[model samples]
Target: MASEPQYRALFLGAGPQMQCGVGQFTRLLGEWIEKAEPGSCTTLTLTRSEGSFTEIWGAVGSARSVVCNFPIVAWKRVMFTPLLAMAMARLRRRKTVLIQHEWAGLHWLRRITYIPALLLANTIVMFSPLVRRELAEDSLVGWTAKKCVLAPLPPNIEAPAGMAASDLRRRLVAARQDGRLVIGHFGSIYPAKQPNALLEIGAILKQRGLRPLIVYVGSFIRGTDNVEEEFHARATELGIADDVIVSGFVASDHEVFGLFGAVDGFCYPLDEGLTARRSSVLACVQAGRPLIVTGPALPDEFDHHARFKELIDRGAIVLVPRGSSADAYADGIVAALKRPPVQAAFDFDGWWQDVANAVRAQL
Candidate 1:
């Protein structure tokens, strides 16, 4: 109730409407806060308009907490900054935390506007080492490190029960019977995601007489220069267009999980520049799907990578070196496909409990 102030927290960054890493980070934080301290905390999310802030607001009202999910472009010469600063000042007397999820300083002016709000917060949470490293590189972390804490993004949904290894192998065999080796990727299509690499891998597979079906699931954000179309065109140019299937944005979790379950292997060939920890890899791990992730080296704290490597040492996920060519990555996939699938004993509930403890300690 407003009569007794709750531990107010403001999640500031673009959100799921933007369908980017930051958006996913904010959404997960909101979930963790609610689940951890139910009825004891209030959340306010500031994101872009495309983000369904209002929809999330309707879901969580002003009773136990208020969801102030609003869109304000910081670079604009609007009065939003003054309004936000005023709001932050008013909420300062309450137990408040401001969480910034963005790693890139896209608009220098926008960073200038948002920096003060972050500095004034009781605590600042960085979702990954990449985020912290970015801040440090920009001298932002020096200003906020005492208040900064590293908390990687959690999976948006709980891991689902996966099909047994026997069932998955049988399905893969059936898919192969169609003369296609199922290779897939999920999440929003962006240049940073490197969809072209998938096309390259498809070409390589075809060269080896292995028909490759590259499936992409997720929609593109509006006005990002239509990178998805470019990817499709490039796939065609690569001579593997017929093998590519771009199924844009499956809405249901079951559909997404099913897609992952049916695939032979998943690819995440992210370019090195865009470095924020990803939850997609976590989803793959939870689904018990084999993976081929490409980016700068992942932090040791990533549970899936650690577990996958452990399993590899124990003869589980087939681990290959980074920068391995499409052929090498394909080899890893083939090896993984042939091996027996062994699901890791992930403690999802325990993971949430750890998150709860972190929030409690902060409070």
Candidate 2:
């Protein structure tokens, strides 16, 4: 009789373009698996194209053992996902795992593609309680109640503690010494992110006798789209174009941290459309920087000063309601910037380890 195939673990959504929380979580999970099981387990990454595929393959090759699973596609069309799933099913034995992210949809016809994999998977990892609720509501897990596990998202990169609080304070003071209050925003540039709202807030700050220097770091997510162009135009219209510095995509975490260090405060003015926890907020917490967030109100748990609740409280972070006018957001930013800095300790490493252990438990 033929011997049964060796049990190998597959990470379904590992790609180079995957830069969000889900990607970070999957990569760290793979690393932990290597450390825990050594050569006994393997990670299978699905890629979209061949170009630069070798680079990613090499990066992951350092793993104790991993495999690259690429599906050729005529375009970015997702029709290939079903075929890929079918192929994966054939290659899979023992048990496989499937990790779901925000975009995992559940249309009846569309569900046909990944439904088989979901049913066959020994474990399914979900990133948030919201995701778990969605899955439970859909009843997509079938009778495999034991297979689902809630795993919190992971940070993209480990945060570095390079600047002391005194040094950071000095940098902020220096930036403000020239009569301009340096307010920084970092993250992807997109309409849903509400970059234009920052420009409007700058105008409001100017009206309040505060000269605002706005700095945006990070490249536009979808290219030179109309939304970004309009955002720039709004700044120009406000006559604060010179005060606004659009630093397109700083690669170094230190450089990003320096920007945070230099700024009086950080602003995140996302619209109500976004639902995921803000990674930028996590970065701010790790960097020990205060924030001026304008959008849907954060949960009450974020209101406490030491705990996660305090991070989102109106006391710690200035919260503006979603759809609030640019002027209202600007007023909130000015008020937040004027408040004295509050020192708080955050355990980023501990957070990652806890999340990793949760994923390990399910595996």
Candidate 3:
């Protein structure tokens, strides 16, 4: 590989050890950036204990550009605050871009740190318009909002290696029933996923005299609530336990997408509503599967957005309100199943080009 001697970018976030969304995003982005500009990248871990202030300072001092992919949510504030302060103090000497992955700044305590970091960075890359709008309300962040750009999270999933969806589907069902309609939910088992909503959808399908099987494609997160147990208990209560298939964690992107391809439809009931940041949603889009998504809890601006309007016009996604009753979700899912499958396509190269252009403009 040819070395790009004069150009360097430092990425700070979770590495492979974290085994979470932030870790995956950080690693994937760093890999792509290095491929784009060989020998011009440095990574300093943030989620892992190996991350040191000395290492961060050393990289920031020499790199032409730096990207901090940090999660500033309240639960993470304790860990992120000091590290962020250390990085920001030295970032004034280089072109810095902060990838704010979550809407942590919605809280006052977190915003006190977030606002100054936004001001110090040369640019900000936000995941959703709602977060961007919230940050823009601040006079300081708003003044520089022109420098902020929106790059929706890309799907980390890929088609399974040499494995046909039909073959995988047969294997998945060998121990279970073979004739039921498979409805899949991917990502970590969390309340935000609304597993209970899936049971409700199943109950509705049963009422309509159809056999529906619920399939979970991800593992449970430790230290959080016992969502998996809760999901099972809820399923038993709904009398759909026998029909549920939990795959635990399918590690490979190939297997994940193969499972996705095998499923009849995908349902994601996110508490935050449908936004660009949900990689699970991106995964569904990549497979071109029929989708049932939850709408924003409150009246919001996304309805007016061109991208969302285009999706609705194409019948690519059906939206039910956040915290909507199971019946409402079931209705949305039923309607989604009836629609012709629309191949939702993403241009990953174009997306990365936009990211590269943003960084180069700052440089």
Candidate 4:
């Protein structure tokens, strides 16, 4: 075999040990990039609140020596804008790619502090066109759009295993003794994630004669652990406590994929519209389960993305308006259930290849 071409690229982001979505993305994407271009890609993990800015500077300086040296230095976490600004000033000779994960994190109060740093970066990678548009509307940062790259977030988890990989499917089926359809919501629970909407969906389904069990496959966000308790309380108030299942954080991606296989469909309701930054959405797509996503308006750009449009064309994802009446939500779910499993439409590996190419091209 031709020796894997050697190249080195620097990544500044959270590592796998951080246990958060950005960290997971950084870890998995870095590994995938290296696999695609062997011996390429080095990462300088971001400092948690516990570490000093000076310490991070030391790490960045050390990582710059790697030969996969490219003109672009990609930074994944935008929350560290100040540090990013300082780093950019020091590494002025190199280009930078700033990947923004959350729309809210770009709030003026927080963002204003880093506006100068953001504009200085070579490329602004926004996960969704809406976010990119929103950023463009901002007077201080709108000009950054000249260099913005719209790369949809790709699924990062291992592909879903065959039914024989686990007994989860059988167990879920058995749990639904009355032929209940179990709908799942994966990823950490947070207000924006809309776990409460699942209750409304379940109630609507029940009234329509299809028993629905809402399963939460991930844990509540830290500092909001009580959110799970509140969910149960709300479910009880709605008189469907037994139908709601909360499975705290699962460590193994295989098990996570197994849970995805167990569900009849994956329901994600978010106010932000289905953006590319959502790894949970990516997970559902990889699971190949019918997807029901409730969000605000679907941007025209979404249709422009060939990959996402293909997923929709294959009946893999169904979009419902955010805050739609329970009847509307229930109707979407029923329609999604009638669709067959999308076994072959997804291009999981192709996404990694694209990511690798982008990194190389930028470098």
Question: Least accurate stretch of 10 residues (summed lDDT) in model 4?
Answer: 65-74
lDDT of 1: 0.57
lDDT of 1 by residue, 9-70 (tens): 43434423434444454465566776866765544444434325344333233232222222
Which of the two candidates, 2 or 3, achieves a greater lDDT against the reference?
3
| lDDT of candidate 4 over 126-192, digit per residue (tens) | 5567777777777766777777776656766757544334455467767666588889998878776
Q: Where does the lowest 10-residue lDDT sum fall in candidate 1?
A: 65-74
Q: Give the top-scoring candidate (lDDT).
A: 3
Q: What is the lDDT of residue 141 in candidate 2?
A: 54
Global lDDT of each candidate: 0.57, 0.56, 0.65, 0.64
* Quality of model 4 by C-alpha lDDT: 0.64
Badly placed stretches (over 4 Å) of model 1 are: 1-4, 8-28, 44-91, 94-96, 105-122, 139-146, 159-175, 273-276, 295-320
- Between candidates 1 and 3, the TM-score winner: 3
- Please say which candidate is ahead in TM-score: 1 or 4: 4
Q: Write the per-residue lDDT of candidate 2 for residues 135-208, one digit (tens) a residue.
A: 56665554553566655554455566674344434555676787788888877676657788788788888878
True-structure lDDT of candidate 2: 0.56
